[model samples]
Each structure stands twice: as structure tokens, then as C-alpha cells.
Target: MQASRTLSRSGVAVATARPVLQFLAIMLIALVAGSTFGIWRGYDPGGYSALTFLETLQGAVGGLNVTLPLMGAGALVMTGILAVMARRDRPVAVAYAFAFVLMAVAAVITRFANQPINADVVTWTPDSMPANWTAIRDVWWHWHVVRTMLSMLGLAVLVLAIMADRNRSSAPSA
Candidate 1:
């Protein structure tokens, strides 16, 4: 009787673990993507003064300094756990792997392309703002667009992978 109870509890754990992992990965990446989208749409400067722009950017950088890295790390860890758990299932594993790679690419874009500019933008005052600020801002904006698209795609891919995994799990046995 004790052995049977232990087995039942194990079964319950296995059943719920995957759902929790999926939820974590999806929600974290969704938050990162959603926040990026909001920034692109609502905070593009639109001809604001250099001081005003730098102030807004400083506020944005402050929040993102905490939020983006945490969300990206959580999403990657959860997706990697899912991928490892699905390793015996080739298609599902591959889908999760692809999702991880896509998200990693987005992170790379953020780290290498976008963040240096953010750091500099946060340091500038109206008097100290670079004479070539327009060019710098345009470049930052372009990379922001790229990461935004990549993150959105990564989220979509992760969702599709979850659906595929569920469908395969529920399919009738051969």
C-alpha cells in the first residue's frame, strides 16, 4: 500500500512539473517581449529635447536593468529544463532547442548591440549629448526592433512547442 501511494505521488509530480515549467518559460519570455514592444512603440523620443530624452532613458534603463536580465535568465533556464526533459522525444526536444536558440539570439542582440548605447544614453545631459546623437539613436532603435521581433518569434515558437508536446502526449498509441 505504501509503495502504491509513493508511485501515485511520483506520477502526480511528473504530470504537474511540465506544466509549471511551460508556464514559467512562456510567461517570462512574454514579459520581456511585451516590455520591449511597449518601449519601441511608446518611448521613441519623437523629437523630445536631449535632456528630456536622457531622463526618460535613465528611467527605462533603471527598470530594465533589473527586469530584462532576470526574465531572460528565467526563461532560458525553464526552456532548457524542458528541452532536457524532452530529449527522448526527438521532435519536441528539437522544438524546445530551437526556441532556446532563438531566445539566446535575442539576448545576444540586447547584450552586444543595444546595451552599450543604453549605457551611453543614460550618461548624457543636454549639453553633453553627442553631436551625432541622431545616428546613435537610430542604430539603437534598429537593434531594438530586431530583438523585439526575435523575442516575439521565440515566444511563438515556445507556444507551438508546448502545443506539439501536448498533442503528441495525448495521441493514441500505435
Candidate 2:
């Protein structure tokens, strides 16, 4: 590789993008994974909320809340880009595509599953809680765990893909 793609024929910048896109995807997924980790550890469904479940949910939506949409969007966009970038390299491409699918599934789980529960939960007060509060909470918790696992799994696959890609890049040509 030449010192720069500035010369155009150097073709150096083209190679740099695979690793950069992989890194961005990794960082974004890692952020989402950490959010899931924090939720499970700090305010899981098992935790009692004297105030109310809605209050608990609302309270947790302060600092991290603003960044969540951005993180999710950034993660998906970056992962998709990485998947497309790796398209010519079959094994590496497949890995990135799998990672993107995993992340997308997590997004779908949030949009269709968790968001509905969240909407209902927002209408609740301590005294207004339905007789089946725990049941609703249980459903929410189950999906949360599933999506969290998928997000982390995506992160792992992304990291490995980047590693494999770099190895291929560095290998001496036959």
C-alpha cells in the first residue's frame, strides 16, 4: 500500500474503509450492548419499585435516553454499511451480513414487542396497575433478554469479522 490514496492509483484508502466501518459498527453495537447490560443489572424487572413501574421506567430515561435513538440508528446504519462493504469477500461478507441481521432482529423486537409494552406501561400509576402487572412485566423481560443476547452476539461476530478481514489483508499472496 502506498502512503495515501491521495495519488488515486495508490488504492490505499479503499483498504482502510473495511476496518473503519467494522470499528464503527463495533462501537455502536457495544454502546447498545452496554445499555442492555445496565438495564438488566440496575433496573431489571425483579427490582421492586415503590414509586410505580412507570415511574421506574420514566426515571431511567434521563441521560442515556437521548442517546439511545442515535445509538440504535448509528448501529444499524454502520452495520449495514459494513455488510455492503464486505460484499465481495464472501466469508467476510457473510459474517457482516449475519451481524447486521442480528442487530436488525433486535431492533424489530424493540419496535414490535417492547414498544407496545412500554406504551401500556406509560399509562400506568401504582394504584392503576392491572391485576396482571407481573405477567406484562414478564413478557417485557423475556424479550429484553432475547434482544440483549442478540445485540451482544452481533458485536462478537463483528469483532471476529474485522479480525479475519485484517488477517486476510496481511496474508502474503500465493
The best candidate in terms of lDDT:
1
Q: Give one digit per residue, the lDDT tens place, for model 1 in 1-174.
A: 999999999978977999999999999999999998898888887576667777887888988966796898899999999999889889999999999998999899899998999889878877888998878878888998899988999999999998998888789999
TM-score between model 1 and native: 0.89
Q: What's the true lDDT of residue 9 in model 1?
A: 99
Summing lDDT over every window of 10 consecutive residues in candidate 1, give the lowest-scoring window.
45-54
Best-fitting candidate, scored by TM-score: 1
lDDT of 2 by residue, 97-145 (tens): 8888888888888778877887787677788888888888889889889
**Can you give the lDDT of residue 1 in candidate 1?**
100
Model 2 lDDT, full chain set: 0.78
